[model samples]
Target chain A: MAKHSFSLSPLSSFILPRGDTLFYLIALFSILSLLIHHLSPVSAESRHFEGFDADEIDDFGDSDEPISAAKHIPPPPPTTTLSVSDPIESHHGPPPPSADPTSQVTSQPSDPKPASTSFEVWDEDEFEGIPQSPPSDSPLITESDTAASAESDPSLKLEPESEPESPKSISSYTVEIVCVSFLIMFVINYFTGKKENEKLALAWASKFATKDSIFDKNFSLLGVGETDDSPLLLKEGQNVFKFYASGRRFCQGLLATMELKSRHDLISRLYNMVVPCKDEITFEVYMNDDAMDHVVVAVAKKKLAKTMQKETTDLQRFASLVSPPSGKKWIAEELAVVAESKEVAGDMLNETVLDQVFGDKAYEKFGKGFISMHFSDQHLGSHKKMLVFKFALPDAKNMADMTRLVALVPYYIDLIGRYKLSSHARTKTDGARMKVAQEIYKELQNARQEALQRKKAEQRKKGEEAEAKLSAEALRKKEAKERARQMKKAMPKMKMTRTG
Target chain B: MSSPANDPRQPSTAKPYKPSPVAPQDLPIDYSGFIAVICGVFGAMFRYKICSWLAIIFSAQSLANMRNMENDLKQISMAMMFGIMGLMTNYLGVGPRGSKKT
Candidate 1:
């Protein structure tokens, strides 16, 4: 096989050697890390907020006074731990009343220790100090001072809030890793697959190129090397019609149009005639690439003739044979009336005249530039089949093309027969009943011999009369010879006297 | 020489041609994928926690099946992404009664 110089670049060579497994491994690892990050519970500094029930929040919202007011308030300062520790005094103190009368009303009536404890964790410094209960007298004064101080300095507490957002950063990083790995794997698979496919295609192209084999006639035919987009030109003078190629599909289509008992028999017969065991035959429909004019026929086989016949009959049962009877009758009457008028003028109503004046009638049934021919059993009795071919011409009416096609039909039949015989021979089944091909050949031989004997008998009949005439003429010639001999003897005496 | 498998009692005809031009009611629909898409929609639009969880599970199962499928990876991945987004919408309470509205 010829070698192609196609090659990958050095960069691709480096990556190609690593193979796709490595990329998949990386992707697998990335997915695993993402899963771990999503599934595993990291110790979130902001706390899991365990026991923070939605129902409890709903209950709080419904409680009306303190809870509704608390829902509006921002989370209290970390220093609120001091205020919470001094809860006994703070709840009753003037600061609570000044802060919100509603909070004092609800907090004073309900237990306030748990709510204050929940708010104490806002600052790490206060979280440790929470264990140590300080004196309420000093803490109460400091708590009020710190609340005012904390309100003035909220930025000092922002550090703890930022610390709890670590999990968000990790999740974003995991998302980025998963996306990048997925992209990398996708690109590697796509390009690697594409490259391998291209290499395989190149290998196949090289093999076909080296072998000088025809993949299909649509690609190349005759001596005309196909340009990428050049049109085929088949003309009469430069190139003649010949067999180009054949295959199963062509034979199947051809067989479909023929009135054969079974597809099996038709195929077997065609196999015998064309290439043995091959089901199609391709005749060169074009002459040469440069030919200005050529004829091509594309045979499109429809349903089997038997099925078509059944369908047509079924359709006929639905209505009269002359469908739309009134309109058809009117058209027939018009044609007849026109015919009468032409006849009265002694003008001819022949096909040529009608075709010239009223356009071709054949075209009305078969469509424009079409000719239909039916091959009867007499022509194809060897196969015991009939075929109808509808030929569409591209040019003016030419009988020569039809004649050529008819001439080729017998050759195809004979070719199919030979093909079948060869196949049967290969199978070594000579004991099988004589095939149609052998029968046809025997009949042809017998007919030829009979015709030869008949010609010889007529020649013999004429030869007998010629023989009798020749015999009588010979007898007369003998008599003339005897008479001449006697006259010669008598003449010798007269000669002697004359000489003396 | 006929076998019992070709018994006369059975219907003689083979199965009707699939992919026929006539009624194609036999065509299989991906019910799992359909459910997932519905759940995803409900979760995103209404922030229904149950719907979001259902969508997540269905989409995960679909994604697992898609690994075995030789084609349409991109489409299945997009569905998985939508499922993820729906889950997030429910988790973050991003709906008509979400934190933003409050």
Candidate 2:
């Protein structure tokens, strides 16, 4: 006997290690750069007002004041007093302007400037007493004096410029903080959510598909190159697992897939919370063509039965809603049936099955978890005949409780494979299928005929278009040739030379 | 019950069933992976940061959950490439309005 080795090396081999590592490194670099860009001092300072610089302000003051000073009074005395007072006031009164500059500037800009000489005289007196006053008292008097001076003097504009910039810088700082926090939150959610989804899938597989389990007993868990101990439930994708069953009598094989919700994605998780959905396990068994008689039957939850009938191709073509026999309810009140005829429904939902479904233990407790089951020998796809069962998966802890439901798969496979439709019911289904086949045939014939006619018409139109494009002489010659041919055909048959 | 060798009525051979391999044409199409690629391209062309991010996430989801490696790899790779391109262009490229204000 060949040795059986079981490992997840095959699964890991599919991952591109270098690609993933490079991708993560690039992502990390981009994120770090984004954070640095936002929090950097250069970006913070850019938010400040850029309209005017101190030199420009000084240039404006120097250029404008001399014109006024030259016109109003002798420039030398005021220049000397202004130069001497400017430095002292700036040093002594800078704190006052910084503290309450906005209010004073707003008030001072409104006040009328009576005389430039008066402002100069007041500045000189204020500078002389500046050192004697306390620091706190100086700001109030200094602000008022500056505001008054600013109205007469242009150089004082620099103090108010810094005021507006403070508010802008603070607002930008708050925005940067918000962006950094959001990036961190997104990264954290992504990794944690991914781990949570993987754990859920692993837990479900461990609980239901161990060695010597029902699945292992019935199905061939080992694939072509896999070992005896290889995991029975193959993880095909993040939320999907597949188990293959072969060596069955009637069906080719059963492909069972467990499809879980997208819990790893934060947005999808939130959406699922708002609109509830379930994780489902689906079993698709393709039966051999001759294994079953002509039949299409589906049993589903009452709410989904209508939709199943509408959407499924075979159900839409051959089956209709089958109400329960005379007085008794369906297999369960919650269940609905759609079948080709009442006879097949009876055969499918017989007394034993009905009793088990209605019994207190299995279906009654986990009834809602039963989604739908469909059987059709006339299915439309590549595998024409199939049996499909879909059930909502319960949580990992309660996985064992659904054993009864899972057992139904093998039981139904055998039962349905051996089932033979009565002669009368078989004829009715055959007639219905024959009628549909004829309808499809007629539709195909009509389409082919239409295409042929369209092609011929297109050829004729192209010939006429070519004729229209000819020169006048060519048109005349073509018409004459047509006339001659008609004349030759129209001429009477002559046998006068052989009359003798 | 009569012995089968003596009776000569029952069939002698019994063959175990082995299922035929699934054909490539029968595999289900990966619709989510296709959608991810489309979103990725639109994100890159339009410079929509949100769309770019969504494309990256969707690509990862598709890649992690793929069923058939041969069938799904091309689509997953295309989606991932476009997603990365979109992110790089939207973040590292100059603003859609031109250079940033000095």
Candidate 3:
């Protein structure tokens, strides 16, 4: 103990007032540690747990040159020094140097060089990597770039070391701020990306985007491409034109749209590929999916109208044809046959067999009338009556029945005029019905002509008829009076005798 | 593990050895260095811009129809989409929605 006290150097030669104070604190603590070490039980027993360490054993050797640390305890100021240098090597330096480099005027060297050695002590400054950064503009910033420098190395998991003054106190408030800022940035970026991606996907899907490119292609290529875009159109068109003359027809509405579109079987594969030509093609675009139904309906409507028109024109021609010179023999033969067979059957009369004998429409008209005789006697006596032949439409309200009866009126009239002038179908049915209907028609025509002629004569005779009648009446009356007077004269003797 | 040479209580030095500057378990971080890392990663991903850019080029039907001399084009768009998605997912440590958990 005496030797130790004698060997103690005056580290006050180097220590500042504050440094000396901390130095004595360390010395006092070290002495207390030594006294505790020797005076306490020597054995490693229950009092000392696993982490407990003794520094008294290190007193002589570890305290060798750094007499400032000769007490075998590090001063607080030196531990706090911020150096870019390594701590362990610097802590082994001369007595006052290893003690405290932290107090700006007290312990740190005035020259930054040898102090640079003491600066190395900061390498041993054990922070949890939470640094104390001075203002960035400070020249001390250069001291922080070092790869292994104590002030330079970031010891925490998050945040840049440039934020050393960022409050090493590690408050809950600071941590929360960092987390919230990070979360806000993440959320903002996420929504922006999501919305733009959705728009891009939609714009990509729209088909007019490519339709401009599909132009100028050939029919088959266009068909294939069209089917590639939409298979429904091809399948529909093929179903309609059963005997499709056109190669690779692109017509839609030719087939069943709804049914086939649902069936994706392998067999429909070939039909699926047919597409339309890209040019001015005849296909009408239907908004509805049932493309084939409307196509057939449009075609049928056109055909029915055409047939009706043709039939009307043919009947007109046949009416005048019966008067032709060549029509004589045929008309006679048809008239004889109809008279023999009371009812001409079926559309047989409407057909051209006996029509060659009579003219066609006239035969059809007459035969149809004979078939519709049921309602022909509606004005008969009150007794309900039955006809000789039973008709399917007993009422004659059947369009066929009505057409037949009404048609006979003109037909028979026409036939008689022809028969009177020539020999066309004067058979009993035709001749009899024709004669009666002819007589009626002639009487009607004569009456109509006479009435019309009478009207004309009335215009000529307005004054003449009245004057002629008046003159005749006047002459007769004059003659009668003259006779009366002559008689009286001739009978004068009788009159005298009568007077006598 | 008990070595007399490493006994802290019987430290042979003239002075007690201060513990190492820091505990061994703590990582050595250079927070300034991470600023460059953040910039580099963001720049690379931004420049990669693979999906948006390639889609625009293909017009969303973004087919890479590389034709042979005979002019036969091959379809490789689907595979490219998967590859790009895989790269993005790996960096994020996750998989896409509706993917089977294998």
Candidate 4:
């Protein structure tokens, strides 16, 4: 390798050693000077050649070393081993899907290279403009060892070797420059771009409403919810809303819709999905950095569908019930309530009657206009098992949170379910079942309420009965004594009258 | 090829040719100088960490009285400020051989 580095070494070897050393010293100082030049600083530094001193310059000049140390380097992308990797499905430069453990797809990794550095065999005819081979099988110069004479120039023809020193560098200045440039360019290309979370947020917003493709010729989004069987609807008059045109939320039109079953379900899903703390939190917790944020869009879709179905039915009922029949409107209204609530029972398992009937309107009114919409506060006897509707006063912010403080909605809904079980404890309406539910609620409230007082009054009734029994016994004894005294007085009066 | 012999053993027949100064040539330089040059180049980079670490240790009074000083220079921010100061000191003004600041 050392013999092969230089072409001029042999021609210069015949010169006097003393004179040769002078030329060598010039080369050495040239390299040391370049070294000092290289260390000054990278970018906008103020100093220039300030690190150089007299002794350093003299020391560099004294050495008889070569100035031809600049090595040859390959072009930009020093060794661009490009192999067209399989073009996997990409959504605008697909995420380096490796980071997302839940995601299945992967970014096409660059072509793999053998993880070793060793001698590479090149084809004999591969060197383009090189020399001819010598007589005794000079083609296969397997190793670096070369002892050919002046008549032969091995590969590139003209050069004969001289130095018997180790090859410290590749010694090709052009190649070195090209390789360094390539490496620097590669490093620069690795860094300027959008963060991963931003891209995910945009993609998620796009896929929020419809299950559609981001980019592809071969694509289809299959609808999963609407099938042969539909879930039970549990609300009478819920308006449906949908998000469309990616990131643009407007109430301009009705495109798709459904009604929610248990309001508790919405709150439950929210609690389950969002990391819960002292209080239930919203999506704004992560804010812009919400990459793992999966929007609970399926719940919204179902609620909207329910709303559309109810509105169409209501329109028909309103027209029919308007004829001569007076009670017809009331009947139609009742049927709508039942049908809407039945929608809930159709889907949910271990179905509770209280949630199906009043879950939709539990937090509805301030207990005005529609009192039966919630059963948690009222005694079961007066309200009975039925679905009710509130006028949806003041237009609650979303489908559920105005009158419905989302935090309080579920507990009230759960209480209604418990209230139903306690109210139905008895087959007959002996008031015991209702009475028990009232007792439980009073216990839950820990307040001296009317319902609690009523139970206390019932308890006092038993005590009064026991007291009355004791008083009756005492009164009988007093009456007997009075009768005996009267009899004695009457007998005395009769005797005295006879004597007279 | 046109040079005459300088010896006068037989007959001094020709003019002696002065040997052209042996052509100024190059020699191989080792990798040690390149290594030294890179070390010197990067030695300036380590000062940032040193100054920042030292600021945390020495100037604790300013750090302790951070809340009272409303000028936004405190432990955390001051450490970062010191780093920038060190880097600027290295870049612009020459001080001691390895001084963080001039």
The top-ranked prediction according to lDDT is 2
Off by more than 4 A, model 1:
A1-164, A167-176, A209-211, A214-500, B1-102
User: Which scores greater on lDDT, model 1 or model 2?
Assistant: 2
Q: How much RMSD separates candidate 4 from the native structure?
A: 42.5
Specify the highest-DockQ model's number.
2
- lDDT of residue A102 for candidate 1: 21
lDDT of 1 by residue, A1-500 (tens): 11122233433533563554356446546644643454344445225544455544443233322222332333333333322332556555465434532222111122223444334334444334343222111112223444566667864321121111112456645644654464455445444533433343233223221233222311222111123222111111111111111121112112111111112222223345665421111222111112211111111212332233234321212111121123221221112211111121112222332332222343243233223322222222222233334433221123232233333332332223222223433243332223435776899999999999999999998988776678777879878999999988887453335554
Q: Tally clashes: model 3.
A: 30
Writing each residue's lDDT as its tens digit, candidate 3 over A1-500 gives 00001212334432543654566456446644643454344343424432223333233123322222212222234234443344445456643433333423222212212233122333323433333322221122122223235354544212221211123355735633553464454445445533333332222212211233211110122221223343212212111110001111111111111111201111122234464111011221111122111000000112332342234332122111122134232332223221122122212233333453234455455443232111111112322111112111112123233233222322322222222211332243344445556776999999999999999999779767765767777879978999999988887463334554
> In terms of lDDT, which candidate is stronger, 2 or 3?
2
lDDT of 2 by residue, A97-151 (tens): 2343333322112112224422322234434523222111112123445557767
TM-score of 2: 0.63
lDDT of 1 by residue, B1-102 (tens): 111132111112212211113223433344456677788667655656566556655554454333113222333544555566555654543223212111
Candidate 2 interface RMSD (Å): 12.1
Off by over 4 Å in 2: A1-210, A220-231, A327-329, A358-362, A491-500, B1-102
| Rank order (by lDDT, best first) | 2, 1, 4, 3
Which is superior by TM-score, 1 or 3?
A: 1
> Which stretches of model 4 miss by more than 4 angstroms?
A1-193, A209-500, B1-80, B90-95, B98-102
Interface root-mean-square deviation, each candidate = 23.5, 12.1, 48.9, 45.2
Instruction: Give residue A390's lDDT in candidate 1 (0 to 100).
Output: 40
Please give the range of 10 consecutive residues that has the lowest summed lDDT in model 1 chain B.
B10-19
Local accuracy of candidate 4 as per-residue lDDT tens digits, A208-246: 222322211111111112221211111111111111111
